[model samples]
Target: MADLLDQKVQAQSLVDVVAERLEAAIISGTLEPGSRLSEQALAASLGVSRGPLREAIRRLEGRKLLERTPNIGVRVAALSLRDLKEILEVREALEGMACALAAQNMSDEDIAALEGLIEAHGEQEAVREGKGYYQESKDFDFHFRIVTGAGNQRLEQMLLGDLYYLLRVYRYKSSTKPGRAKEALVEHQNIVAAIRNRDAGAAEGAMRVHLRNARRYVEEQLVEEGEAVVDPAPRKTGRVGSLR
Candidate 1:
C-alpha cells in the first residue's frame, strides 16, 4: 500500500498563483507597508473564494509580511534597516558562492549572455537617467545571470529569493544612490573579469565586496532615515530559499 505521505504532487489552485502574486506585490512595494489586506475585497478583485485567499494570506503571514493581529487580521510588514542588513548578509554569502562556481563552470554561452547583458545595461546614463523600474529589472538580470551561470540550482534560487524582498525596500527608498549605480556596474565588470580569467578566488572576492558594499549602503540609509530602530523585528521567513 502506498503511504499517504508519499502521494503524488497535486495541482495548485488559482489561489496559490494569486498568493505568489500578492507575495511579489508586497515584495515589490506594490502593497505598501502597514497596509491592511481586505479579505472580501481581495477575493472579489481576484475572483476567488475566501478560503484560498485566507490561506494565501496565512502563507504570507508565515513569510513575515502579513502579521496576524489579535482581532484585526493582518498588515503588511514594514521594512527596517536591521532587517535589510540581515537579508543582505545572507545574500552576500550566497552570491559570493555563485560567483566562485560561475568562474569555474560558466560556459561560452553564459559568458556571452553576461557580456551582452552588461553592455546593454551598463550605461551609466541609462541607470542614472533611466526609469527606476528599468534599472531594477536590469540589476535583476545581471544577478540572475550569475546565479544561472553557477550551475547550482538551489543556491541560485536562494539568492534571487532574498533579493526580491530587498528589491521592495529598494523601490521605496532609492536604495542605489545616484553614483552608486555606475559603481555597481563597474563592480559587476570586476566580477566578470575575474570569472573570465577563471580566477575563482578573485571572482569570489569581488562578489563579496560588491554585496558588502550594498549591505553597508542600505544599512546606512536605514539609520539615516530614522527607520533604524534600537532593535528591529526579526524576519518572518525568507520569501524563497531554494535556488533552482
Candidate 2:
C-alpha cells in the first residue's frame, strides 16, 4: 500500500513540474499565443512520456492558459485588446490592495530592496542613454516584490498563479509603443517613493494610477491602428520569491 501511494505521489509531482515548465514557456512568449501544442513533439523534446505530457496539458487547460478543440488538439491562449484592458482593470484592484498592505507591513530591508530594483531599471541602456526601454524582467520584479510584501497567501497565489503568465504575454505584445517605456520608469519611481514613506493610501493610489495609465495607453494605440477591440470576458480574480 505504501509503495503504491508513493508511486502515485511521484507521478503527480512530475506532472506538476511539467506543467510549470510549460507555463513558463507560454508566459515568456517562447510558445506564442495561438501556437499549437503538439503532444508527441513536446513529449519527445522534454524527454517525458506521453502520459505525463498529456496530464500537464490538462493542467494548463484548467488554468485557461491552453484551449483545446475537438479537431485542433491544444493551442496557447490568445488575448485580444479587450482581454488586455480587462486584465489591467483586475490588476488595478488586486495590486492596489497589495501596495497598500506592503506599505504598512513590509520590512525596512524589503523596501530598500525594491528601491534597488528601481535603480537597476534606471541604469538600463534605454533609460540611461535614451535609446532603449526598460527590460520586462526588471519591471516585473518591482511589482512582484510589493505583492509578496503584502503577506497574503491567497492574494499572492491569485496574482502570481492566475494572472501573471497572461500579463507577460500582453506586455510583450504592447511593448513597442513609443515613449511609454521611459514614462513607465518614472511612474515606478513614484510608486517606490510612496512605499518608502510607508504611506499606504498614497502607495495604493500611485499603483492604481500607473496601471490605469498603462491601460489607457494601450486602448489609444489600438484605436490608432484601427484594430477592433473586443470586450473582455469577466473572470473572477502573487508575488513572491525569485521569478527567474
Task: Name the top TM-score candidate.
Answer: 2
Q: Give the Cα-based TM-score of candidate 1 against the true structure.
A: 0.63
**Best candidate, lDDT:** 2
Worst 10 residues of 1 by lDDT: 1-10
Model 2 weakest 10-residue run by lDDT: 235-244
Write one digit per residue (lDDT tens) for candidate 2, span 66-175: 88777556777766776777778998999999999999999999888888888887887656654334244323467778889999988898787766756765554344
Candidate 1 residues 122-173, lDDT tens each? 6645465522323333234677778878999899677655345435455424
Alpha-carbon runs more than 4 Å astray in model 2: 1-31, 37-63, 124-140, 221-244
TM-score of each: 0.63, 0.66
